[model samples]
Target chain A: MQRVNQTLGRIPPWLIYGIAAFPPVWFFWLGLNGGLGVEPIKELEHRLGELALQVLIATLAIRPLREWTHVNLLKLRRSLGVVTFAYVSLHLLVWLVLDVQILSEIWADIVKRPYITVGMAGFILMIPMVVTSNNLSLRKLGPKKWRRLHRLMYPVCVLAGLHFVMLTKGFQFEPLIYLALILVLLAARVPWNLGRATA
Target chain B: MAGRYKSDLKWSDVTPKADWINRRQLMAGSGALALGSTAGPAVASLGAQKTDWGAGLEPNTVEEITTYNNYYEFGTDKGDPAMHAHALTTEPWSIEIDGLVDQPGSYGLEDILKSVTLEERIYRLRCVERWSMVVPWVGFELADLLAMAGVQPSAKYVAFETALRPDEMPGVSYPIIDWPYKEGLRLDEAMHPLTIMATGLYDEPMPNQNGAPIRLVVPWKYGYKSIKSVVRISLVEEQPPTAWNNYSANEYGFYSNVNPDRDHPRWSQKYERRVGGGLFAKQEPTLFMNGYADEVGSLYAGMDLIENH
Candidate 1:
């Protein structure tokens, strides 16, 4: 565990950001090259949403991973969170500009569709977390309030999972598996009282 | 297969070279006046028919047709059918036509084709998923096939069932929406000229994923209403249990017509992204009955579509 921590600590945060930035770039390249299949916009939107969820899941795992394995990824958590927000925003933008492309229908979809409503809720909740992600806001709000505010991730994850589940045609198991994983992670944080723990 | 027929015969030339040879062999062997007499007028009319239903829209590329599909029995993903459906055994296939039909029995695909004529029908396929495509399907009208089976007056609906082979279809393991996918149409809708039994696409035999061997294509309704890899077709009095309706009664209806006004419970049907139109392509406004209302609208003239849907 000590050796793992030492190795992780040695890696620069910039390197982590560089590695994390690859997916969106690769996905865009694929989009430009006709690699996203027949319905490229749908594929692009789906991929962005999936990446956002994956990054969120990874960000949520950082603390638990440190507690269990003693290999701290605390330094990269903020980067992961920022990347997740970026992907989520891109996902929304694609749906708004490229996919739907109608102002009235977009509003109607977010209001009418249960899945999109949940997804928009998640995105809305993420705004505060993204706004106060830096050290300046962290210092201004203090550690206690910041910790409380950040705990909103739990509900955000649930909403994201629900969005995924409801988007599918029938009772698909894939989205349910993601929801289960999020629930297990959330459960792990409960007994430890890690919500109060500082990064 | 016999030599390829000349191209100058127009789209109405339903007599493929192999069928012509088979007809000659049957005539020489048995002197079957009964079969010839019955088939003569139908063949003659088919030969004279020339219909361009696509209006000027070019058919989607063969790559799109072969790759993108919605055969849920194969899997839920669009690409799943293309990957997994090749495991299906399409040869030696037969369809069981029963219920209110006079001649109710398992009929071989070859025998069925011998009696019917194949025509090129360019159709706009609007999926319930809000994606659309134009496909040039090669087959005959479902009404002709129903007539061949001799539909009774008691038959109010036509129920179609896809073949189930859990061993070959990996999607069946998930129990997505029951084993064999099923769909139904009102007797009038079934008899509509737009409802066809598609055997080939892009002038080629259908790829396994695209419901190879035979499938139904109802242009007026959502694509799911057109069941794939049909193994059984029954003319019944009651509306049969459809797969999607059985899965989610509120979301999927028995009729499932392509109406832009009636949004799906989860998503809007007002607009559809045309497949192969690239990422930045604007979504087209969905036409009522996918633009086939001019021909099929009278079928539901008295019924409230929203209530029926």
Candidate 2:
């Protein structure tokens, strides 16, 4: 675990961002070229959303990994969160521009559809986290306050998971598993967080 | 009970389980979607005379119609049916026709095909998932099928059932839906000329994912109303159960008629994207009865469609 931490230290956190940036481009290229299948817009929209959820899961996993395994990937967490936000934004853009393609349905859906409401709320919550992700904001607000604001990710993650669960037609297990995994990751941190606060 | 619906099926008869998956990967590798049919027979292209139905609308490409499907017996993903359906053995298939019909017995597919005259119907299929497709189907009318069976006066509805081969259909193994997917129509809707039991598209034999052998195609209703891979047709007095309606009674109704004013809780609304319209295709306004209201609107003249939905 120490060796893994050392290796992770040497790998710049920007490298994760750089690598994460490539998929949206690759997926967009696929969308343009018919590689995303017959209904490329829908596939592209779903793929981006799934990627966002997976990246967000990776973000949530970081603290647990450091606590349990003694492998610190603290630097990569912020980068991963930023990447997740970008993918979420892309996912929203695809739905608005390509999939739905109507301006009226945009606000109407968020109002009418519970899943869309949850997803939009999640995306809105991400805005503050993304804004505060920088070192400037970290220093301006100080670590304690900055950390408190960023814990908004907990609700964001929950809402994102709920969004997926609600949108599915049948009782699909995949989205439920994602929601379960997120809850587990969040629950695992509660004891450690309480212990640290008391200490 | 589901075990009763499982046919003697093996992927080995089509292509080795390992090989069929590889075939999809290979097709996916070769540019776009060259998938969906390799596991089944070499599609025989027929040259049936075209009908005036859906005359002005351009039919979507065969690839779009076959590759993007919602045959949940195979899987829920639109492409799932195409990817996994080819393994189904549709040849020598038989459907049990009973319940208030004069001739109540198992009828073979070959015999049914021989009895009915084939016609090309290019119809717009609006799915409950907010996507639409125009398909050119070659098959006979359900009214004809009902006529051949001789419906009794007591029969007020026509209930349909999809072939449930758990060995072949992987989705059937999942508890997502009550197995042996079912659908129904009022006797009048069943007898409507527009309601067809499609055997093929693009003059080719039905692709497995698109409901091979014989499938219902109700142009005026949401695509799910048009059940796939039909194995049973019963003329009953009471309204029979439908797959979506059984899954979620509030969301998916028995009528399931396309109404632009009606909105699904999540997926549907007044708008639908026409597949094969390329990326950034503007969503067209979903039509009432999917633009077949002129012919079939009187059928539901008195009922509240939104309540039914």
Candidate 3:
């Protein structure tokens, strides 16, 4: 059994596509099945939004988690980053398709609603992260510059959380918890050496 | 309680009087019977608050209270009530009227409707959640309904309770609150002419999610002050604990009046977005007494609104 497990674990990293696809696939299934309750479509829109934020945060933590644990999770980061983009695209699609239903209305809502403005800003920032996650693009931008570009995730997460807080009219504990979680993740990244030792 | 007017009150200090009228006379004239529910296609044709109804001193605004809702039981979203209340049983309901009243029994919803002569009142509904709706409610004034019950003067406040059915409302499954949501108003507020017991909107039966059968509509207060799907009304001397107050005492005051000046402990209460009117529509400054200063403002004349809030 131990030898069989080792053999299974040694399989090509791309074979792990199943695990990477699970959250979006499961949430999509939940949205379609009406498991999200009476306003399933709206719930889907919100979940896709939160999931986009979550995947971004998780992707941000990959370096810290790998460094702390001494476990190489290098192969999974690109797929996860792309998945974050996918969820964000879905989130924007829901607003465009279900909510605005018209390009003019979408433009109007984006301008009018503050939360929508912040959410759109976060989506726009994710474009570079999505583009730079590829191997060829990483070589083009260089590793140092690429890492700095991805650090935009910190502000993106904060803005995404702010977008959520603004959307909930009344006091909601869930968004606050997300905000707190992001803060701790950010706090963990405080550089003691300021990259002087690395340089 | 009185010296310099609180910075919030712009005009001279006006006492919020009870403005209580003869509940019995109003009830008798309204032409309702206390037995079976009024059966008809009354609500099938949804009308705006300002439609055709018999005339005599009608409220200037015809906002539909039944259509505008903040019943979070359906969901936290504004649109949840219309979508989630489909599973509710609005028909064959009963309200248990107890505590300090001469008559205490489980009265059928239909009987309550028939017993009172329904009037259409147009009033502004401001939600504590920062939204406003102008609803024209069709129902008898609360004073009219209480008159039929022969209320004893000892009843200083009226406590209202919503039906608690965990099976029907999934939101209640997780202790979002202590079930059978409760709210109360001072005897004076309860007896005020502006306080209504609405049964229908848009010329049709009230939708189940909007608190069908019978619900309180206190336009002067925030939307939550208008309790929905009220199953019980208890007249008591003690200050009753209210639902939002219990959930967060600091955030939701017992009075919950629609005063734009007295901010909720967390957020500013200066402005509200009117629903269906898309964003950027000029926000109307919320009135101190929800625009019922002429009718109910005198009742709280000496009370410090910020302290009460």
Candidate 4:
């Protein structure tokens, strides 16, 4: 137990990669167990939405939790953002495989469902973050350019949360709580220059 | 006495001991149980109670009477009863039946089962929140027990409560939903042929979260109306308050009818994704009254369904 605690005290980047791989592990479990029932595609779609929401929330939570609790989980930040990308990709794959079972139908759903449109936009915006998350890209882009480029996460989180809230037609209290938490976390990170100094 | 109870059972054909033990262990720890087919040996072990009535369902190897469930002490979740109800002292279970009943005393679970001639009924369970299951319930009609108890004409509705034990059901420690879950149906709904005070399922006694001794089942209504782990049954003149309504009045109304046309503000009620149906099975269109309209439709006649719903 002491050894385990000691190991946890060290921040391994592979740990982030391992944590990032869990959505696929869960997807595999769902596939193996026949847990998805008749709606594997639909379940897959919902799973993506949930995973995206979770990753987005985790990404938004990093700065606040770090400042408040002072635990440097910063290594997890980029990886969690990538996991969000992976989940969103899987969500899109299910649509291709089960839903529509055809490309035309997939295109039609993307056009018809406004929620899908917003989700697609969120996924599209995430490509740059995932591309730039690498150490190689960080060196080429430099800290100033990389930080500015990653600012896209804010609108992506907003669109993703809104996509979830809008898709749920009734009063789903759980999603409301998620939205509230994300807003507070995001609000806490407002730029200093944006606020007027009190005289 | 144990031999007499076990007379109908064939131990060899019982559910695999390992599986039953594991399930019992899991169910003992969890307050709710999952819905699935049970093996034969398990059914035989659970089906030992003497009963003159034939099970309404065709007995199958994997079919069992008492399914695992997850109804937390505070409320029912599909998985709750199996996960959180081990500490519930169901052995000394007693139900207080009063108000408009000639017999208004507490009754024990053992006594209640012995008195009723348990029958089997296969019914499609439609949850108000929009999931469904086809269950073979092993118990007499609620009216048979109510008639024996002698309900007065003034008894308009029947209200049921689950015993609230916080120490056993740790979920109650947090206020997610109301404790001591309550459900009600019109007297007519209670006495419907389809409605049952289920004692067993698949062939065994109900697990603790499945409402061990007794629970209500109104097939026409959403699953919530079928209260589990019942501790009280009171016949009232006015429609009493129900659990879901208390939680969200606008979302879950008192008359939570099974209407395919009336969509939940959040989701479509036009169709339902059956809980156990495998992939590629099209979501079956939800029926107006869970396909029990012929039996229960007349009961609500002349009343505005939109208003009540």
Prediction 4 global C-alpha lDDT: 0.67
Considering only chain B, report the TM-score of each candidate against the true chain B: 0.84, 0.88, 0.79, 0.78
The CAPRI class of candidate 1 is medium
Q: Spell out the clash pairs found in candidate 2.
A: none
TM-score of each: 0.89, 0.91, 0.62, 0.71
Looking at model 3 chain A, report the run of 10 residues with the lowest lDDT sum.
A33-42
Predicted candidate 2 versus true structure: per-residue lDDT over A1-199, tens digit per residue: 7788888877877788789889999999988877887789989999999999999999999988887788899878888999999999999999988887667788898888899999999999999999988999999999999999999999999999999999888768899999999999998877565547520
How badly does each model clash, as a count of residue pairs? 0, 0, 32, 44
Model number with the top DockQ: 2
TM-score of decoy 1: 0.89
Stretches off by above 4 angstroms in model 4 are A1-22, A34-50, A61-82, A89-152, A155-184, A191-199, B1-70, B74-80, B279-281
Best by TM-score: 2
Displacement of residue A65 (Cα, Å) in model 3 is 8.7
Predicted candidate 4 versus true structure: per-residue lDDT over A80-199, tens digit per residue: 788778888877776566444545545755776677788789889999999898999999999999999998998888888877776652234566777788888788887656565411
lDDT of 4 by residue, B1-309 (tens): 111111232333334546645544544222123342222243554453433222222232221223324364523333444444555766788888888999998887778777766765556777664556666556777777787679998889988887777777766765656766788888888877677888766556665656666788777787777888788989999988887788777667787878876655544566665554444434567889888787778988898876678
Model 3 regions more than 4 Å off: A1-52, A61-199, B1-68
Q: Between the candidate structures 3 and 4, which one is better when assessed by lDDT?
A: 3
i-RMSD of model 4 (Å, 1 decimal): 6.0
Compare candidates 2 and 4 on lDDT and give the better one: 2
TM-score of chain A of 3: 0.81
Query: Which segments of model 2 are wrong by more than 4 Å?
Result: A192-199, B1-34, B38-43
